[model samples]
Target: MTQPEPLPSAAATPAPAEPPSRPSLPSLPGLPDLPDSHVDAVELSGPRFQTEPAQVYRELRQRHGPVAPVLLHGGVPAWLVLGYREVLQVTQDAALFSRDSSLWRLWSAIPEDWPLRPLIGEKQESILFTVGEVHRKRADAVNEALFGIDPFALRDRSERIADTLIDGFCERGSSDLIAEYARLLPALVLAYFFGFSDSEADEVTHSINDMMDGAETAVESQAAFYTACRELVAAKREHPGADATSRLISRSPTGSEEEIVQDLMVMFAAAHQPTAEWIGNTLRLMLTDERFALSLSGGRRSVGWAMNEVLWEDTPSQNVAGRWPTRDTVLGGQRLHAGDLLVLGFAAANTDPQVRPDPAVSTQGNSAFLSFGHGEHGCPMTGRESAETIARAGIEALLDRLPDVDLAVPAQDLLWRPSPWMRGLSALPVRFTPGPRTLG
Candidate 1:
């Protein structure tokens, strides 16, 4: 059987170029549009992403020549950078492409019901939207906190959590892997790091996932998230622990409780769903691709190898939005004006013929694509290691327990959540021989 091939054959080849873009169209534009917003912007959030992002990314690549236009949450216009080298140019050259959302042109024009307001608004205190000195200050604290994490201990905790979660369904012989395993493992692990009780992990994940869905409840979910983080911060301050959150509280430069709370919130919010979804994506590979499955489960290939493949092909965030241009610039022959918002097409860039060219071989670093982001805004020291370890140990425990696990439903029937920026399976139902539960 053919290996996953890093998301279909198109990933190994350059996306076919489309006919010239047509400007002045009322709806999303065709491929021929040139020079940044010359044609209408395509909608980034929709069924298209939920179904096939690689296919959609290839189409977008063909359509606008890599740096094209896309409408964000609430019909906001922005450039979607699809080329690998172009993504590198935008993310690495922070001088030209700033993370500061203030430069985002649509911030002021967006409607009150703007769906991504929490993610992009200035009121959101996550370091993701900061730039320059402010970002450095935040990153410093985060980096230190991440450094304090004990990976060995973290891995052990993750395995135990995975075993616990599997016990909830192993006896039934059928389960939605996404909800029961992939999604829960990271949440519980993160709750430990954030110094919350394991029992609270489900609620933490539910709130973050709700925010990711951007439903009517999302606003209220985020507000509740704030309150939880604030409480966690106070508890950590009053009675410190060795967890990552306590480290963050001690290292944070801010005296304001609000700033401290934002730091903790971003840690849990940023780390949970995206990490969980990507873990789900990796599990999908194990279930669908026989060669990949055998290699991973048989110990010939490590989970890290499979994970890199997932990041290359089925990254959690297909199109991470909102990198505003700091000045008028030209990227891939596309003219980008100052404050022109740009979305980094991580999946598309990973497949760019100029970058990967051959999925059969592995790319050595995270910088190979924007999966973990780049430059000042990249994930912290223990971030990648901690995440990979958790995913690996959790999956390993399950595979050890249920080597015959396979999809309970057809792969095509599985659906992903519909969000403009991220890609994640809504549920992954699986069936395995009924087995005794793992003991505590």
Candidate 2:
């Protein structure tokens, strides 16, 4: 693959070769007057993102090159890093492009009730918003907590969880796998690891699902999550255990309870929804694609292939809110000013024509996809492994129990959730043979 041009340093002077002039950016309603640099900036929402994001990214690349200017919710201006190389440049260089949301320049203009505020996360001390050496320490704490988990034990517990969930609907022979299985398994397992009682886990799981889905209860759900985490931190402090929350507390002795709570929130928020979506999307692939369906009988390796293909083709984490430049810089030949927000386009980068010349090609055993991100802020290795173990075990257990499972609805009739930041099915209805209860 051809290498992308070297990015000009954020503090360095621009090269003598100037970009060619283009027509002024088309105006949108209620947008404040700004520099004319953003020509034909696209809104990150709407039907295009929900229905056809890959095509949307391709069109944006064709029109505006790799680093395209885009409008977020409530018309917040930001750049979407759409190229594989551009995303790498942004993610790899923490000094130039920081994950600190407090550096964002538009905070004063943003409304109090701005929906995207939770995601942009300005002034939050969570590990997600931490940078530099402090971030490394927090990340280390998270890694230790997650790494302490035994993969074999996790896989076995996940199998039991999957069986328990399937028990609810296994006798019916028809179910919405997204709601009944995929979405619940990760929450239950994570909750157990965090030491939440069954009742607390149920409540926290509902709040998490509501927040991740961007539902009407999102604000309340966000508050609920914090409250739950704070309580967990307080409880774990007095009586330490082998649970992840207790481990995090013991690991970060110097960190504040608030910071620890926030980091726990980050772990739960990061792991739960994406893992659930991975399970849902992988199941969708297996149910729809004949190549995978044929392998359902005895082909266990195909399960891994389907998981990897989903990461490449329909990553759950489509866009991340994102790296902010420390100073003016030129990336992918486009000028970006100081404090500008850059949404990491994971799905777009995975499909960039430069690396993936053929979309139809198999990506099995290729782990270069940026679905979990890259560099210092990438998903911790331990976290990724736990998610994979949970997902793979969930899928394998379901297949083992129901070998003849098939889609109850037409493939064309399936609908995707309308969230620009996430790509997942709204519901995956399927039919299978009714079996005897396993846990009884």
Candidate 3:
């Protein structure tokens, strides 16, 4: 089928009066240059949506200037919208740009009843994937449920969990930080949020890890997680607990055991991977950058800065947000037909010079980084207040309990997650002098 036509307004926006300032293109450390051999292949297939799209994106920006059409994932036609202004416009204008992926013809191949549909499809209530009013409402509820709880109330319990994991590693002198520590912490927190008991929390964590390793998409893993969530919600209904999941279930309009369970699964699936990557990336940054590590060691407040820097320098989700053109619109001086898919390259946009003054300093928490995104659809959870609260507390506890922590292996030897959508170290082995267990 012919790709959807670009809405009329797609061609109406005038190009900016002045060119955006951006750093001169830099060669990737180790990658082949685009060949004339694949020019036709590329156009037919669309932009390659692989682990190293950054190189292709940089090349497109240089060759096409700002706005250019490129194929994505082999054959899907999409506008590789680069430059700060264009990206900002596309991300902010909900009317012009729609985040609904269902409109795209590419996803039509998947059956409507596919398990992954609620997680990645274009349907309303697909919190992370849908767009328009439905996206707004469900997203608001999810955010409220996720962040609405007082993380401080659980600080004591969280610290105990963090310390117990750290102690196990300090004794061994080396452990896979990602698999053992970073991954475990968030799952435990999420379990508490879902009102699972401590032992039940361990079970949920194991189930989540298994599901992540086993399934390629959110739908593939939903059945197992949904089952666990359903059990927990049923228990909460009988004996209302103090956890966030229970609280949300209590107040929800759709408080049936099934709906509550499904929503929890959606929330956990959306949050688990991203948060795990964040923790893994944060540890990697501290271990590699002595200057950054020193800053964290010197003051507890610096953790927020460090987290922001990591978000920019090591963007976890390369393709977190997407939009389809609602009407004809011009982004980066390229006309977009209605139904055309516009994938926001947070990785590319975060490093753009026009939007960020020193793209390289993204590691330094420059205010301009688009890590959390921008406009109405931007990640509302990021900002000074939340960052200070979460990072400071976690880092302070870590430093107080494990002051001499150092990587056991060379930084270059670390393995990174293979997905382009998220950047994270697969494992972090470290040795630290153990301190007296003061809290746990």
Candidate 4:
């Protein structure tokens, strides 16, 4: 729950005291290393994400080089990998940075009620926890379901859904973009694809919200999520349709109901938040940045350009948890335990000087950013219906239709959710001239 990076403090008084720059932890003989329990629990929504993450990350980079130690929600210590090349080296090397829970040192120490349980905890065996052959087998079924979808066609359907959602608010000349458009579209799309009815989709979205937001009832919501997914899977199995759930169930090598349900749950859970945040953040970028607004609106710039820039500058998921070292190793001049937990700072790495001295160049292509990550454990949304395609399509639907759309409030006033793991807005109130329903 710590900030991605802590920034230099702002002194409101006459003078500001300089925080002693501790660049690297001392690994001297007989000197005790910093304990994970000692690191502060500064949640993302706790005034850090809005005002401090970038600066905090910058300070860590200046001090530690690339990877630095930080405390997760439960006083669980882990290394936050902040360098671009360093992140690539760690994530790409499966033998070194294993994703298997067997290598996670801090998981056992974490208390049951830890607030980040929903984000970091996995009660059931899913693709996120396994590695090697296990991951390959489980991933094949999930990938067949995910990569099988057509992105261009999915975009068309998502656009139609976006239009319907907009129609609800178009008359008022104002809307909460996050709630009405960004969030709802994916829920509806995923629900339809998984064979859930409209009412079920609404409830599924509710459970998904509770789970993703780490609400106090998250664990309960996760249970409810499992139940809903099982029902969906069961129905699909009995009546086998063209939906992803049906495909996943039929293709699964294990042929186990529990495993099938877990995989289905993972697919929905993974897609919901990241995809929504990408749309919301990308829209926020297009609206707030005048150059972006003008260029994209006028067709002088491409949606692909805006999407790439947002992916690099403000990654939808700032912190990716659960990358552990398979053996004792030295990272960023600090010694790591064999099974120590480490975080991948996707946003920080995207900004690492070694990767891109000028972030604006991110729009130019090359696609080296770790936001989608790489290697065997990379994002499953790799094919056409990827975040990039969905976001571009969704953004086009809104901007192309509502060109006058602008922030209803000052950009500075917009709020960001406090969960340290995600980079998302609480709401995006937008106002545009009343537009007609795009749907017939």
lDDT (CA) for every model shown? 0.74, 0.86, 0.61, 0.74
Candidate 1: where is the Cα deviation over 4 Å? 1-36, 295-302, 359-367
Model 4 alpha-carbon miss at residue 412, Å? 1.2
Instruction: Look at candidate 4 and give me any clashing residue pairs.
Output: 5-56, 5-57, 6-56, 7-55, 7-56, 23-63, 45-418
Return the clash pairs for model 2, or none.
none
Q: Candidate 3 regions off by >4 Å?
A: 1-56, 65-74, 109-119, 122-125, 129-132, 214-221, 253-259, 295-301, 360-365, 382-392, 434-440
Residue-wise C-alpha lDDT for candidate 1, range 310-341, written one tens digit per residue: 88778886767668888888988788789887
Question: Is candidate 1 or 3 superior in lDDT?
Answer: 1
State which candidate, 2 or 3, has the greater lDDT: 2
lDDT by residue for model 3 (1-440), tens: 23321111212234333333222223233323333322321231211333345554555565555655544332334565567677788887877787767666446444455333433455544345556665666556556666666766556656777877777666555667788877777778667766778888887787787666544643444455667787777777788766767665765654556555656776675566666677777777777887577754565545666677766767676655367887776677666667766667677776665656554543553566666677776765722233334344555566666666778888878777645456667678887765554434
Candidate 4's C-alpha runs over 4 A off are: 1-45, 295-301, 360-362, 381-384
Candidate 2 minimal-lDDT segment of 10 residues = 1-10
Q: Give me the candidate number with maximum TM-score.
A: 2
Give candidate 2's whole-model lDDT: 0.86
Candidate 3: count of backbone clashes, pairs at least 3 residues apart or interchain: 22
